[model samples]
Target: MPSAHRERRRVTWWVALPAALALMAVVLGLLLLVAWLRLLPDALDPFGTRTEDRTGPALLESIQDMSRYEAASGNFQVVVDLDKDAKFLPDAVRGSRTLFVGAGTVGAHVDLGGLGEDAVTVTEDRKSATVTLPRARLGRAALDADRSYAVAKERGLLDRLGDVFSDNPNDEREVHRLAVRHIEEAARESDLTDRAERNTRTMLENLIRSLGYERITVRFAPPSG
Candidate 1:
């Protein structure tokens, strides 16, 4: 009986006792990890996801859906000075002259929204492509109010007297308009349209080349009314 009890004690010390202690340690570690994670306020994703697969058809549709493609634009700067003389009486009697100077900018652009289905053509072997685009044109000019300012202005005695009793405001708005008009006129006379056409051609050629075409031909159709 004594020998049997000794053998049982040895087995517990070497195998069963160590196994039970290891199992308890594993459970304790798991419990501590759970508690630590619960202390954090936000849940965290272990795996980072950033990109997705993009298909060719989806990309093509997006390009076709564009309503306007600005091939090129020019920012034309100008300074303008204007004056107007006013009088309540005959020519030299108590007349007022307004001399004002202002500066501003305008833009010239091209339109490509008129491209039709027949505009693009690809060869049978897909080695070459021809793209027809509309001629470049100027769009509505925009004024950069932040960049524009009145350089100088002066109102004569008659004008100041008229303003004291009249509800009419100063002619600053009109002066600004004239400055913008001058910029537009100057841009019209420049080679902005020609530059836009050349840029458009280069852009189409590069785009077609990116699509695996060895040779690309770009042409501009006659302008439409």
Candidate 2:
């Protein structure tokens, strides 16, 4: 009976030894895995999700011919603070405020296409020439999407909920339009047109000089009221 009891105890020890080693191995493997994950970069996480663009190819749009010469371009930037609030309602319930930084470019052009037959006058001896051109005009403001962005946004609880349900949440068209408007106004107030006219005059003078015209006079038409 003593021998049989000792044999049973030995058998139980052998079984428990393998089980303990297996549990230790499993814990060590888990620790190693956690360390490896910690060392990995956030962008390279194995369990992280990724986004893809499944948009279709672009379509062909109509093209138009351009004859005007772009003489000068001016870059502009503005800060736009836009706010909306519901009448008689608290700001927390139904209000929104956004601060946007807008960057854009406005170009001035000379419309050579509008020149008529009588636009240029020359001396009878062909020793000099006088050219008349329309005053330079400002082109449309082109916003740089890469440089323009929203600096801050604050939306009420109701407004935040609307974003979750709306198809085009937090649409920026209004802000973009306002920024373009401001840029256009600034361009109009600046001397971009005068610079453009001066550049155009210089260009025409050089060209006319190359044609052996000793005296060249460039005149721009007055801006119509």
**Candidate 1, position 166, lDDT:** 86
Give the whole-model CA lDDT for all candidates, comma-separated.
0.69, 0.91
Candidate topping lDDT: 2
Residues 117-198 of candidate 1 have per-residue lDDT tens digits of 8989998999989988777777755777777776665656665677789856446667667766777787788788788888
lDDT of 2 by residue, 1-225 (tens): 999999999999999999999999998787668657776565855544579999999998988788888999999999989999999899999999989899999999999997999999999988799999999999999999999999998989998898888855435888888899999999999999999999999999999999989899999999788
State the lDDT at 223 in candidate 1. 68
lDDT of 1: 0.69
RMSD of each: 24.4, 6.4
> TM-score of every model?
0.60, 0.79
TM-score of model number 2: 0.79
